[model samples]
Target chain A: MYNILLFAKRELRVFVDTPVGYVVLAVFPATMAALFFLAGSFFAESEATLRNFFTWMPIAMALLVPALTMRMWSEEIREGTEELLLTWPIRLRELVLGKFLGALSLLFLTLLATAMIPMTVAYLGDVDGGVVLAGYCGTFLLGAVCASLGLLLSSLTRNQIVAWLSSAAILIALNLLGLAATARSIPPSLAHALETLDLGLHFYSMSRGVIDAADLLFFLGLTLFFLVCNGLVLERRLRR
Target chain B: MMSPDSSVLAVKVQGLKKSYGSIAALQGVDFEAPVGAVTAFLGPNGAGKTTAIRILTGSLLPDAGSVHLFGADALRSGQDLKKRVGYLPENNPLWPEMTVEETLAFAWSAQGRVGHKMSAVERVVVSVGLEPVFRRRIQECSKGFRQRVGLAQALIHDPELVILDEPTNGLDPLQVIQIRELVRELGRQKTVLLTTHVLPEVEALADRVVLLHEGKKVVEGTLAEVTSVKAGQQQFKVTVNGSEEDLKSMLATAGVTRLESGFPSSSAQASAVVLADGGQEIFEAAVKHDLVLLELAPRSGTLESLFYGLTQAEGLHV
Candidate 1:
């Protein structure tokens, strides 16, 4: 755990020292807030509260989270610092977990800043507090899972651009592949399985004020799977 | 130089081998570095110097053989060994974005020793001569300073053994001398294994030299013991202001074989001949020839000759 924390601290410092942190942290919410306010103001007849904010985050994160996490190990490898880090007494899991927690923290802060849209809705009308709270919880958890997946992919290659593009591609396919409502002829079981893989299915369910155990389990499982893979990738390199 | 009665062995390897695909990097390399002395890992480029260092430090596992560091199995107890071992790789990478102070703190923390706060970090920085650049980012520092920071990182935890590979690679002559001094100082009390192509470095710093060739231990011993050939029968080089034939005849009269000559540059005919079995006898012969012996000096006999001699004379264990 101490190893993980130290890794996390180092990761945090990387963010603070580089321009990526400021650009990502500030731009994410700024873009989300602009789109949310603009959509809300333009569509006066819309009945739902803060739907615009929650709706855009999934799409925004598909590209953004990969950009944030793909450099986690790729940079280390390219810089030859992997040799130094692997030589340390810390286990592979500790290093991976540290990076995961650090990247997740930054993503968490970005997501938190978007909460202003929900707050604005509550000020303007009778917003469903329970559903709003659940939506935030779902978004945060799903984002964490996506970040972990991106970090794992990043660990696979030293070229940051390749890591970002591949991670984004996988995320886009998973998040958008099941949303063809027009394909009504598809079998129910297969469609449900496909929807289970979608970020929207689980996220939308939570946003409706329903806290389903399976949905939370899905996000947690995805996060753990990718984190484990990240650990494995590092293990291969450590022993070499 | 491990005592037979002593239970602790600094490093022990048996049949150590590592192959990257078809190219067998290390094959059947075996040796031991005992506790409490500096051992020089000497070899030329592609001699697997860095590979051996990596394997010993637990950064790289071998394809075959076992390594024990300080009585712990290197393969099984890798993390435990790594905790007790500090390594400074050939080209030490510093996070250029970090200040000298920040980098030192991170290195200390990376070793899992978090109790060392700012003051302790400062002490190491000062020891490594990084005080002036404590606040400066590593990218802004010179190459010498970067190396000092690398040394500081390796020494941060005060590990039982310190492994440095080519620590003097890019430094200027002055920096090289300073680093050598520091290494000599560190070696007085710690077990240090440093790799270098510089033969004189081995002569100056290493108590014993381990000559590696093509990933195998070709030679291992104290400087004189490893490099000295025809042991107990000394060697000499002589330059005479006389005809090559005259010098050869003079040494021939004394019964010297394997007579060799250096290129005649300008006014002098310089020749070096070896007496296969004579030491002082050969020296006396050169003096009596009236050959105007311009220079006659004893060959300090270095790991370089041993390395070149071993690689050329016979191929190492494949």
Candidate 2:
């Protein structure tokens, strides 16, 4: 447990010391705000809620989370520091969890930065705080899922670009699975399975102020699945 | 080689085997490092030196092997045993973006040590001479200082067994000397196992030598034991100003056997190998036969000659 925190602190320090952290911090909120205010329907319906912000959240996270977590394991392998790290007196699971939490923390901060959009919506007119709170909760959970997936892909290769692209591609596929076009082209039963597996669909349910147990379990289960797979990949490398 | 008592051995491996796809990295190799001694691990490229070190340090696992460190089952102990062993792997991998201070802290904390972190960091900092670059980012430091940081992290928790792979690689002569001095100092109290291609460094620092060839233990013994010719016989190269017949007869009278004769030269100064340590008797025989001895020095006993002879033998080339 102590070693886990040590690794977590080291990961956070690396993020803070490098430019990648600031880049994500700036790019994520900027893209989310631009899509919400300009490209989204924030003014078309004249609603006093951050519904458009929540709508654009998953897309923004899909692009930004991969960029945030791509270097977590890939850079270590590229620099040959994995030997040093793995040889330390720490378990593989702790290392995986610590890095996952570190990336999740940064994602949390990125989401926190966009709080001003909701603040602006509240200042302009009446806004339901419960829906806004649920939206933020759902967005953070969605980001955690993305972070774990990005970390798993990062462990598979030493090239950060490959890690980023593979993670982004898979995430974009999962996000698009629930689209009408995708659902219509597939058979009904297959489409239903894909919809249940869609990452964006689960977040969409939570964004509407409905934090159902099924949706919570979906996010948690998927996140754990990716993290376990990440651990197995690392363990296999150690044995090899 | 002295029979290693498992109790006194800092590191012990038996029948260690590891293969990558079709290529075998370590093939049924056994190695031992005694407590409080510097054991130089020498091998040619692809001789499984790094692979063996990785397995000992718990960075990698072997398919069929048992690693015991300080009388404990290292392969099973895992993290608990790792705290007692410090490893500076080949190439000295480190976080280039981290400051020297932060790297030491991370290493110290990774050991799960309980104390004032500053004091622990300062101790290694002083030992490895990392004070000047303590706050400097690793990437900004020179290769020598970067190597020092690598050493510092390995020693941060005062581990009992220190494993260093090519510690002075790519350093200038002065830096090499400094690091060798530090390694020699470490060997006084801790069990030190280091791998190097530099044979002279082994002669200068290693109390024992282990040579590997083709992922197998070629030799393991003290420096004198590894370099010695047989049990009681010694070989010497002698340059004499006399006929080959005269040199043979002279050496024969001194109880020395001529192993090989060099090519006859016009200058009448030919070298021959004599298998005996009768230096005084050979000199007396040469004087009696009126054969002027030019040079008579021990042959085929230096670490360089032994390393080349063992590693470059048939089927040993990488």
Candidate 3:
């Protein structure tokens, strides 16, 4: 626990020191807000809620979260700092968890920046408070899942661009999970599994103020799955 | 394997084997470093010096073998033994965006000793003479200062065993001298294992030498013991105006060993030769004879020749 925070603190500092971190943190919400107000026609919609922002975040995070997490391990490995970190007395899990939490913390702040859109909706007219809070919860869960995916892919390569592209490809496939669920060619059983496995399905279910245990379990389990995979890859490098 | 209570041998590895695909990085390499001694790990470029250092420092795993550090199982102990180990890897990995103070503090946290942070960092800073660039970012500092930072971080925890790989690779002569001084000081109190191609560095700092070739140790012993054959028999080259017989007769009465008069060195013809207990006595003999001495150089009796001879025999010459 202590080692995790030790690494997490360093990861946070990396964001502050580098322009990439600042650009990702600010641009993520700015682009989301722009898509919400400009492209989606915020005032023209006949609803007093931030449904547009919540709807756009899944697709936005598919690319944006990868951008944020691409540098997590790729830069460390490329620059040889990975050797220093690995040889430190801390366990490998603590280092991975610390960096993951550090990246998620930035995502938390970016999500918080978009709260003004819902706050504006509430000011204009009646808005569902439970739904707004649940949407924020759902966003955090999605970011956690995507961030872990980015981290796992980042460990597989020394190049940040490769990490970014590979993670973006997988994330794009995940974002399109709903389409696979309704496709006819994948067979009824596989299509059913696809719907059950869909990230968007769980996130959307939570966004509607449901907060089901199954949805939370799916996100938590998937995040843990990817974190374990990342840990395995790092350990394998040391061994083989 | 060393018993847990034994401190005579600081590190021991046996039958270590590692391979990447079909290329073996280490094969049946055995090594040991005695406690409280400065040991030099010498090898050619493709040798397993760095590979061995990586395993000892807990950064790399060997395919088959065991490593015991200060009598602790390095393979299975996880981070416990590593707490007593400090490693400065090749290239001196550091955070360029971080200030020297920040890097030191992070190392303190890494050792799981968060209390007395300021004193610990300040102690290392002073030890490395890093007071001038305490707040400077790593990228802005020169390579020598960056090396000082690397050394400082490695020593911040005061580990029992310190391992440095190519610590003075890209430094000026003055910087090398400074690092050599610091390393010599470190050897007085701590057990140090360093790898270098610089033969004089071994002569100046190492108490013991371990020379590896083609992933195997070809020579390991005391500095004098290891270089005994190459530089053991004392012989000096002499260049004087006197004839060979005249020079030989003048030094015949001196307490000298067998003297040979020939061109033993490649770049010069033989003026004279003195097989003596020490090279300085040649000057005294020349002065006593009123002979005009031109050049008096010792034969290649140093680590450089020993390194070349050993590696060349193994076909691993650098």
Candidate 4:
């Protein structure tokens, strides 16, 4: 656990030290704001709530989170530093969790910057603080899932572009699972399973102010699943 | 030639074998390095030197072999035995995105040490002379500086065993000397096992030499034992300044067994073989013939020639 924190701090410092890290942080909020205000109709609604703004976050993060996590393992493999990392005394679990939470911490801080949206809406009119808090929770879980999936793909290759493209494809496929399950051509049993696995369904539910235990478990479980896959990939490399 | 039966061995390998796809990287290689000695692993490209080191360092698993480092089974140990062993791989890799200080700190912490990390970082930085570039990003540093940084991180933990694969691969001659000095210093207290193509490096620092060829150990012993007198083959270069007929008659009477040439021109470059303990007879023959010997240098084996001879299968160069 201590090893995880040490590496997490190292990863956070990497974000600060590099100009790209700051660029990612800055551009995410701007793009999220643009998609929130310009792309959607927040002013069109009577209620002064950030529901529309929070609704589009997971879709935007489908692109943004990969950008943040693409270089996590891709760059390490490309630079041959993975060899050193693999041989170090640190456990595979420590290294994976460290980088995962590190990316998540950055995701949290970036979300923190978006607090102005909720604060602005609250100042203008009455807003449900419960829904707003739940929105942040859902977005955080979605980002963790995206980051873990991104890290797993990063472990597949040394090319960040490949990691980015492959992770984006998987995230898009995940968001479409519920729609696929709704198709009349598919069997009901398989459709039900697909609906249960649909990531967007859980993310949207949490964003709409409903933090069901099942919904929370869905996102957290998916994140853990990908992280475990990432760890297995790294462990396999050691045997090679 | 000699294994320390009483003293502890820092590294021991037996029947080590590894294959990549259809290519065999190592084929039943075996060697051991005792404590506090500099052992040079000499071999040509694709000679299993790096593969052997990787297995010893616990970074790669071998197909059929056993490796013991400091009495810990490399194949079975689970508690990060590598923290006690330092390894600088063939192409030393570092985080180019991080500064030199950050890189060293990351390496130090990766070992899971609890004490203040910077003190150990400072110690290695000084030991490797990396203070000047402490704040420079690794991408901004030169190749030599990057190699030094690689060495610093490997040494930061003060490991009991140091494994350097081609430690002086690419560097200026002076930088090579500096690294060699640092490695020799480390050898005084820590067992240093290094692989280098440079024969002078072996001569200057290695107390023992393990030469490999085509993924197998051809020889392992003291430098002198391997490079000195092969067997009963006595070779010498003689330059006699006397008439050919007179030199021949003198040599025949004085027990010089075989001359490369039936008749020798006085003072010409020629090789001669004498009977057992017959070097004295050659000198006596030269004196009896009144030959003014310009050169009488004895031709003995050198590491360079021995390496070439041992690893001459194909594509092997010094």
Ranking by DockQ: 2, 3, 1, 4
The C-alpha lDDT values of all candidates are 0.78, 0.85, 0.83, 0.80
Steric clash pairs (candidate 2): none
Which candidate has the highest DockQ of all?
Answer: 2
Q: Write the per-residue lDDT of candidate 1 for residues A1-240, one digit (tens) a residue.
A: 888878887877888778878888788877887887775552575565766667776778888889888888898888778889878888888888999998887777777766676777777778888888888888888788889989999899999999999998988878875785327887888787787788777777786778899999989999999999998887777556
Residue A154 displacement in candidate 4 (angstroms): 0.7
Model 2 regions more than 4 Å off:
A180-185, B1-7, B230-300, B315-318
Model 2 C-alpha lDDT per residue in residues B141-198, reported as the tens digit of each score: 9999999999988999999889999999999999999999899888877888999889
Tell me how candidate 4 scores on lDDT.
Answer: 0.80
Predicted model with the maximum lDDT: 2
Instruction: Give me the runs in candidate 4 sitting further than 4 Å from their true place.
Output: B1-6, B229-299, B313-318
Interface RMSD of the predictions, in order shown? 1.6, 0.9, 1.0, 1.6
Worst 10-residue lDDT window for candidate 2 chain B reads: B309-318
The TM-scores, one per candidate, come to 0.86, 0.89, 0.87, 0.86
Chain A alone, TM-score per model:
0.91, 0.95, 0.96, 0.96
Q: What clash pairs does model 3 have?
A: B231-B301
Model 2, TM vs. native: 0.89
Chain A TM-score for candidate 4 is: 0.96
lDDT of 2 by residue, A49-144 (tens): 787789887877888889889999999999899999888888999999999988987787778887878888888899999999998899888988
Model 1 TM-score on chain A: 0.91
